[model samples]
Target: MKASRWARAAALLVLVGFTASCGLPRVGPNKREIYSGSVQREGDAFIVSVNDRVTRATAVVPALGFSAAFRNAGIVGSDTIRPGDTLGLTIYENVDDGLLAGQGLNATMLEEVQVDGAGFIFVPYAGRIRAAGNTPEAIRRLITERLADQTPDPQVMVRRVAGDGATVTVTGAVTQQGVFAIERPTRTLSAMLARAGGVAVEPETARVKVIRNGHTGEVWFEELFEDPQADIALRGGDRVLVEADTRSFTALGATGNQTRVRFETQTISAIEAIAQVGGLSPTTGDPTGVFIFRNEPEEIAKQVLGRTDLIGAQRLVYVLDLTEPNGLFLARDFVIRDGDTVYVTEAPFAQWSKALSAVSGTLGLASSLASIADNLNNN
Candidate 1:
């Protein structure tokens, strides 16, 4: 009788597996092209509207394509220059007066200068000079020429009042929001960010925005940070912005990919979310029980009814029956909303597997107890 019982249980397990086969095809969700032409258009509009090219590119472009755009536009994602940058100057021929006082040409005293937004520095004698873009060596030459025409053996010294000129401002998701003074003369956007602080979060999907003369442009954080040769270089009036990581969701259990996913609200679809998580774990998943649990259930129903109200309550807790083969296409067309949790149910076979495992575990424990009791009796 015991043998017969075991046989029957084994047959039941097999039947469970067989019946599940008819429900829905078990496979990883199809790879989705999350970023499409429409997304590109919308992102472009955002960039234009913000008047900041950096904002549009980071938030709008397909994550992959954004990198290319950033490279082309010369936006740096991670570099920053802040207050307290160091500037040094050496004076030739005029060291006799002991250096001009306060970045001046006065004999005997030279003083460190302060820079302003217009890139100009006020000197004791020469007044304000545009010093933002000029290289150190170049500035030195200019001083030499200016002094030669004034006093005999006029020695002039040039140095950064502070190293602020080589730096830039980086806000958003960087380690810190501040100015990062560039160390080397040939400072790229990437280098500036490293100096200020690296990114504060994951680089993937992180948006990199740059503001130039109030015009905003965007790119991927990685492209601007990791790829220096191609993506990040600073131009005058360039500002690098890195946005913080946005909240996303995960699709598991019966879904195509059993992986965690990140997406903007209303940007992903039920189908696309499934494919991103590496599909459901086959041994423990049910393909047909694909459901999305949203806080706004009504929002989902509105979509089914083709109503203009894209978000409602019922839509939040709606379920998708992928048992029908054609549902695959429909899933692709559906847009996923933020905070929507996708769940795939367990098939009968999976349930049976769980039951059998539980039974086996229980029996093993019992047997171990029996053996211990028998040994005690013998003793």
Candidate 2:
């Protein structure tokens, strides 16, 4: 009985040490710069920002009245076609009844046309067709005239065999990967993604960028998701890349989960931010260390705390304490801006438990190994 009790006690001691190691307080040492501030809490909820700064303008305006920004931003132009672009065409005078023979298009090589990388498609009987700068109607008329000499009543139908031009590239978190061909006008970015088997990972933020004519343009993905007017249409030969969320906000220090969240809008609330992080850990989290680091000094915390000494009127640190129950109400109302960080500190006991647990695990593991070795030797 005594030996069994001793063995059990030893095992418990080892486990206690292991538990302590896992309990250590985590204070991330790196001081990352961020933009954080307090926003007044109101019962009403509203959208953060309506205007997008990066996507609103383009670089140049063509004679066609399309803005320069539209071109620089990759929003317009035939050379700027992306995957899932639709090209429509109506043939003019040359209708080919002989080739059809009351059935369909003849199996002759003359019916085949090759689309090139430069946004040009070649019709066998028509020779080199200039499609880069021309609209679908223009391409059809050009084809109709070229075949007028050889075949009477030559009717030409023009549409994209795949994409507006030739190929489209998908970058970032997609599954099947790389640039691919668009074979039909009914294809879409969403459809292509579905064909590609969808995105590899579901990020906190989701967005798609359209690159064309060597320019980067952003699609209003949220608008596209909501079927709004702000959503831009895609073109052939355009590269569509769906990447992980570009913006992220980090929550460090004392929280249930120290994780980063994607930023969708310009403004977020402290309560919302806390909710994203899974809230406070019951045993270790301290209400006092809840802070939003900014360019300002510690004195910033004083205003939030309604106290004057701790923040010291310095211009470097901004801290906020949620010790008071009313602080929760204030925090719920406070607005957290983009690129903000929310941190909470662990209690002293929690920190000590973590440190002791670490030391205990190392010692316990060593002791367990030593006991096993002794038993083996005895056997």
Candidate 3:
């Protein structure tokens, strides 16, 4: 009886392994395009381990593409004069002995001078002086010097007419839309938005695009406040647009949640992002196989794949091995870019557990069948 029982138990174990073949390591959930490909640009994506070389050379993404725009912040809102400017000139001379006093005219006179197309402003005796690229104080000194020969100790003053020139074009998603002049010292992006009565709609989806000259820079509206770098200086003729942020990403597989999530902030790290989607399912999630699929830019993708022949594949799969302690750290630092797909692989033990369950059922069934046979033989 003992030998027979042992044989039966051994048979059940074999049946369990055979029936559970489907639950193997390379099962359906684990064999997605993200796991199969080696290079990113190969239609499907392959995992690129986050190492020092890759991390240093190929930056973990969510690249805001704001570098070019942030760099231009230094150039906007210069006090230097430009064409289409209006200046307020006040000439004061001592009634006893100054240049105006010598002219036998009024001791003080106020004149509003409009800058011409050539960026030159005309004075009574100064002819045409170049006002462009010069500040008001510089222009005032220049005028004083020019009138020095005309009269004894001439006192001249120059000022920019308020609400006159250097205006920023505020359009798109503004409660108050108008052409507002950029006050001296150059106004910031937030100042302009406030002037427009703030955003009309919920700020959750708003994005601010600053287009200056031929270079255009776009950033999420919230970011403009959180990071000063994003609030670039507004220049004359610069177009500022506040529109909805349309970037989103899809989450699938064993994650706690599977849906399209919009970018709520300017940037998000992988760890917090996973939490936002309910994180990996404890019951079925594979701690070793957290992955992110993204169709990234060619330049950014190259940093990870290190392949020059990236002809067909713009798709990439980034993985985090949650089983390793280091993975948690990497996840904290890893950035999740817009349009990325977050997925967690099914647990490796899920198949084993199912197969063992089947075996246990088979064992109980075999035991009952054997008892019935013994009863029949005795009868």
Candidate 4:
């Protein structure tokens, strides 16, 4: 009976050992598995070791800007007239009974003279005059010349009042969103944003976009204050939009948290990204197998790998060994882009510990069964 018990115990030990050698349940792939999935090893991903060279080569800062046409555009005249504008005209004639005024009056007041869609405004005897594309002073001169031909020494004074001409539409993430007239105080992009009650989102992450004549342009909100060149001039019929930044990276594997984390600032480093996710998991994280997965653009891939033959975006796996001498510095300098994945592999000893615990539990159950059989036989 003792010999049978020993044989069964040995068989159970072999079964547990076989199971442990085959595999154990894990949260993610190990370091060896990740390395085996490299392109050099016939895998679909390219693996690059993170170092000073890689950090320098991949240090890309994402920025928004306008095209040359938008940036180099001259500021528009605020007093320029356009269609749909309201002109307030005051006409004074030398004769007591003028064509525009009454028999006893010498001045004729025209209120709310709306410019038509064809950029023309009609007067009592001045006929139809082109008002759009001309300033108030130019329109006054044109009206005076037309009335001089009918009346004696007619003097015309044209002033622009509240109108819809040369206006910009401001919307999204602002204190007030509406169509605003382009006055002298709000002629440029920055001035217009201020007149619209400023940006409602955080300035660090605010993005401003402008669409004019189907050509679109974008810029960082902070850049408008920091760089004068970024504050492009606004045009008539311009649509301005302000919004928050949407850049983020996914944190997975043996980290403190597993989720998509947003960028808290304009630019973030790898160390900052790891800290954002609550750092690595002390129990299961392998300090030498921190990997960053990203799809590098063709031009960036060429610069990073020093190879020019690469086409399109390439899948890249950047390995960071925190155990190295300068690993922390490299991580601190490496830039984390918008749609990246930060993964930390499990330690080798962690898997071994799991397998040992499983084997010990199975052996303890076998011992309990043997003791039960011995007690029954004695009875």
Candidate 5:
């Protein structure tokens, strides 16, 4: 009986050792396993060490902007007339009962004179006159000259009212959505947004998109105000839209929170990203094995790896060792791009702890069974 008891104890010890060596369940692969599955070991992914040089090379911030054709375009004149515009004209005759007025009146008031699609307006004696592309003063001069031959020393005044010309359509995340005129104070992108009662969303995450002549240009709402060049001039028939940012990154493995986290600011560093997810798991997280998985474009991949042989987008795993002296600084400088996966591997000892706990529970159950057998035998 003593030999059997010793044999059972030895078997339990062997069983515990086998279970531990065979690998217990883990949250994720450890540092050594991750490294073994790298491109150097015929894996599909390339493993890169995040250092000062890599941080600088891969510190890319995504920016939205207009093309040269959109940015270089000149500002539209506020007073210029165009088709679908309303003009208010007042014509004064030097003498009563002249060509434009009766005996009691000296002026003829013409309100709501709409310019035709052909860019011409018809007056009594002026006939068909080109009104589009001319300012109110220019049109006043032309009408005066035309009526001078009919009425002696005729004086004319042309006023521009609410018109479709030089107007932009403002929509999306704004306080109000409507077609706004590109007036003197609201001719640029920033002014137009202000005229629409400002953006309704957070300024840091707001995105402004302008579509002109079937071409689209986009810029951040904050950037549109900060960068003067980004506040391009608005044109007639331009559609302006304001929206919120949609960029996000996934947090997995031994992180404090495993989920998809949206960007809270216009730009964020890796350290900020980890903090946004409640930081790493204090108990199970491996501080030396913080990894960032990203699919980088070919150009960026070349810059990051210093090699041009790779084509198209390449999968890259960047390792960050927070144990290093400058690791926090390095993380602070490393930009977290859209659609990145931040994974924190579990510490090596965490798996060992789990295995030891399992073994201890098994030994307790065996001891309980042995006590039951001895009690039955004594009975």
Candidate 6:
């Protein structure tokens, strides 16, 4: 029993030494800038302070939801004829009427004509016809007029059978990325994406960009499905790009988890943020010190203090007190932006607990070692 006590004392001393020599995250030598009083609103571009009240404007992120930030471009122009196109032509003449049956052919003559490098197609009887920059309907009219001289009441049908001139290219973050054809007046952006097997990931965390006529525009992935106006029309030379967005916020301090959370959705609530990290540590967390750090807009900042600070006070801090019953409901309604920091302070008793535990452990080790030494001396 005496030997066992000595061994336990040695082991306990080793453990205590190891803990003392090393540094833990929040318990290390690093001084928290929060307590330095450096966060002042006067003459500073970036500022921080206590904001106990929640406002409608600051509590919501619209672009992640209804998207008031996204200005709809509305419906746009669609595909038009271009070079490198093939046309399917069908000519119909009354075979039984015996009117202009000079060739004695059947009721219909089917032909596939490819537009030449000069943007013209040659029909056997109609001669070279300009098919580029003109719709199939316009081509049919021109062909019918030309064939009128050869046969009475000539009927001509023209349609684009194959063409790169009327298609858009879809690339990036799609299962089957490729060029897709556009046949109607509507924007083919969504259809092309569907044909390419949709986005690789969910639309909530993706972004889409459109490049057309030397101009480029971008929108949130969910905008395409939620707002019809966001699906801008696809021109023949248009390019649609889809990309995954790994947006996230960091939860630190006395919360359940201390890691980054990727935002799969456009927005996340403050209450949800707390639950994600495993909620506040029941023993060591300060329920009244929950804080969210973010960069406030200049316009809103102007409203808050009436003018820009010398330091450009863009930094804003939000505090929530969970002890209050209404704070829970308010937290649920509060929205958190990307890259925001959620921190919970340590409880008042946390330091006392650490000190008491350390002292108790040291005294117990000294007592065990003294008892073991007494047994040895007596022997």
What are the per-model numbers of colliding residue pairs? 63, 32, 2, 0, 0, 11
Error of 6 at 2 (Å): 31
TM-score winner between 4 and 5, please give it: 5
Tell how far residue 186 is off in model 2, in angstroms.
Answer: 7.0
- State the lDDT of candidate 2 residue by residue for 1-379, as single tens digits: 9999999888866776666556444665322212222132322211121112211211111111123453333334433333333444434333435432333543232232444556566565577777665655677778778877867766666664444345566777778776555544324556566556667755334566767678665543343445433344445566777775555668987787888887654346666787788887788777655665433224443443344566333222234456765666656656564456777766657656765667667788999999999999999
lDDT of every model, 2 decimals: 0.54, 0.54, 0.72, 0.89, 0.88, 0.69
Q: Which pairs clash (backbone N, Cα, C closer than 3 Å) in model 4?
A: none
Residues 230-251 of candidate 3: C-alpha lDDT, one tens digit per residue: 7777777777888866677777
**Count: clashes, candidate 5:** 0
Candidate 3's TM-score: 0.58
Q: The CA-based lDDT of model 1 is what?
A: 0.54
Which residue ranges in model 1 land beyond 4 Å of their true spot? 1-88, 94-112, 115-146, 149-151, 155-167, 171-203, 209-219, 222-239, 252-278, 281-284, 295-304, 308-314, 321-323, 327-337, 349-379
Model 6 per-residue lDDT tens digits across residues 111-225? 4577778889887777898988788888889988987887778877776653556667889999987766566533556777887788998877788887777767777877877
For candidate 6, the per-residue lDDT at 375 reads 100
Candidate 3: clashing pairs of residues = 41-313, 42-313
TM-score for each candidate, following the candidate numbering: 0.47, 0.47, 0.58, 0.78, 0.79, 0.69
User: On TM-score, who's better, 1 or 6?
Assistant: 6
Number of the predicted model whose lDDT against the real structure is largest: 4
lDDT of 4 by residue, 192-274 (tens): 99998999999999999999999999999999999898999888789999989999999988889999998889999988998
RMSD, every candidate, angstroms: 12.4, 13.1, 10.1, 5.8, 5.2, 7.4
